[model samples]
Target: MNMTLTENTLVKDIVNELPKSSDVFKRNRIDFCCGGNIPLTEAAALADISLESLINELNEVVEKSDSGEIDWKFWMEKDSEAIIDHVISQYHNPLREELANLSPYVTKVSRVHGGHRPELLKVYELFYEFKKEMLDHAEKEEAIVFPLIKMLDANTVENREEALNAIKELEKEHDHAGSLLKELRIITSDFIPPAEACGTYRLVYKRLEMLEGETFNHVHLENNILFPRFN
Candidate 1:
């Protein structure tokens, strides 16, 4: 397959076809997950990147990927159970551990720096809210939504409506989480630490940035790939 990316290509489509394109998007800070429905041109404009440059990079990746120089699996090609298992192990478990470990860093950074950088306080508060919501969301997925999805996938769903409603609710929660992440990015100026930021401050910013990226990818898999299968 000879794939040449154009401005009209959707961000999500690129990621779906060439998963490694996600690394390029991540490097450019382009949202290819929750906000990935837009075209490449629009995404570039939003991120203030040159459309030509973006397209060139993506097309290069596509060529290399097509040449078998990269390992890219289409998640949509996987069975529902396989996809669910991947999400749980690759995203859910790591997210839980990271959130727990990063919580203290957020608190410590905010408490120590809030007096000087009021934004850290907001980061602290938002992180708390996000942590609570994400942990609950993951638990709900494992305990309720995921099981229901499995039933739906296996054609043994007793209450089809219930499964559909659960998926809808989870998507709504994803939107809320995405909004919180956007706010965090804005408040922290794209997670850039201040000039006098100490070791802990820098570390917190880095970890928070990583958290935002991972959450976006997680939501993307569910919102664009997994949930859409049942929808």
Candidate 2:
């Protein structure tokens, strides 16, 4: 059974439990990824949306969603190793490929369109940093952090504090990633392509929008579900 959602519910909790509700938050221009720790009331206020309307929409979608569709809760039932394995296969591997695939389009759009739309220049720079940061973050997770997490799960780690600190750092990195995504949205005007946009230009924006959604779901799993196990 779905819990009664209220204005006081944490944004991440709602997204964590009812994944489809992210659509409602997204449509309302709410940040349900990085800034998801705040309450719906706070998020609604920040987005300048009607709290009642937001709650109603969230409830409607959540009600329409089958309880078995709760991926977040499903993952919660798994062991840390299982969760880590799934994250690697489901998010980490695909993210690396998607970022690489989207790179050329981001560059082409910025190079061709930046003269008239200077914001594309910023988008280019931000995406460059975002890409580099994400790549490095994933490397750290796979090479160092994930192994330690698995060890911690098995009670084989001698340095529990070190593992804990590493998890905290990952959380900080997740916040930075969320900030970069928010800036991308701001500069791209919520990923709405210009009227005169070329095919490649429009494609980049669409991909970036999809990236935002994927990254949100990715981070939501880590920040709210996986990381909390260590905390």
Candidate 3:
């Protein structure tokens, strides 16, 4: 709270300076990743939240982290290739694995519970479509977007406009994926399990919650850090 924080500060900069501040932003449903360039005042307005309340929460988190506990900023300072590599290794690969592993559980849960809870059927359908779309999204990034970015980083001669356009397309895909996840959140009531939920039912929700968090961070890296450099 003692620091010179204000409404004009960039959301991404706030997250970079105080890594713990992401929790506050996430809790407030502020977009600190794709829409990170927006100022805090505007972001608060868009989220329909009080600016002062959000700033206070961010300051509190910063204060708590003053004990030298959570000092590591998330992926802000890395080079393009390093950032891309981290994205692939830390998020994309694991997401594919998780999707494959969780698909069965989702189907089983929906089949067993859909008799009473019709929502589970919708959940399974949405998740299946999301998985397929995300797989293709990852492939596009790996095959087309990421390589061009690395080329740009290396100063290699290529079609700059083409690469930029590809990045724009990738941003659109990110938005679509984000929208799908938001629908999933609404359908699952923020991934809360029912009173009659079985073990597999609970596990499906847990893995889904984890996937949502990781997907947010994954998109944050590309939308805020990687793409901006090329744009």
Candidate 4:
């Protein structure tokens, strides 16, 4: 709201300051996760967007966002247990439900449209595979990795090595999920529905796009915020 952000600020720091800014970065195709450490001006240049324009859009989004309802910076002050619980309840649980619910639409669309739109077949295959992998990934985080993280938070000396190892493995899984998301984006032409696309087809693409955004934020929280504190 105050336009406090500048081009020199790191992309991740911008997102950290205003979590809703992620939608702006995603829309602009700016990398605010693995490459998030880079300054906003550099990120804008890499994405082929004008720095002044991007900053203006981000500020506008920040101004409109209800920061009082959701404070991204609050996570920085939370203890590890509280953060883990928030991640589980907010990201992990919703991801599980959405992945489960969206699979049916994906299947139905591919069945109806795969003849003309052959890419739907690939989309169907990739999504199911991604879903399966993600379900397993979420399971590991909930059953194994998360508990270890909490243990580390409690200063359990024996859990440190195991927690670090588990986190490394989880990061690898995140990379695999990211790769699938990229493939999905490419196959769907950035999730644009074709001209003749039916309502269901459009819905499938829309949900897929939503899935991509949610997963990016979910992974960002873990890879950037959660893991670093323990590691």
> In model 3, which runs have C-alpha deviations exceeding 4 angstroms?
1-74
The all-Cα superposition gives candidate 4 an RMSD in Å to the true structure of 13.4
Best by TM-score: 2
Show model 4 residue runs off by greater than 4 Å: 1-70, 157-159
Question: How does candidate 4 fare on TM-score?
Answer: 0.69
RMSD of 3: 15.1
Lowest lDDT sum, 10 consecutive residues, model 4, at 64-73
Q: What is the Å distance of residue 131 in model 4 from its true position?
A: 0.6
lDDT of 4 by residue, 43-159 (tens): 989999899999899888677543444455777777878888888887888778777767777898899889999999999999999999999998999999888888788777485
Can you list the residue pairs that collide in candidate 1? Answer: none
lDDT (0 to 1) per candidate: 0.83, 0.83, 0.81, 0.82
Tell me the lDDT of candidate 4: 0.82
Q: 143-172, model 2: which lDDT tens digit per residue? A: 999999998888999899999999999999
Q: Is candidate 1 or candidate 3 better by TM-score?
A: 1
Model 1 lDDT tens row, 5-61:
788999877766665566688779897756789999999999999999999888777
Worst 10 residues of 3 by lDDT: 64-73
Task: Give the higher-TM-score candidate: 3 or 4.
Answer: 4
Q: Considering lDDT, which of the candidate structures 2 and 3 is the better prediction for this target?
A: 2
lDDT, residue 42, model 2:
93
RMSD per prediction, one decimal?
13.3, 13.6, 15.1, 13.4
What's the CA error at residue 177 for candidate 1, in Å?
Answer: 0.6
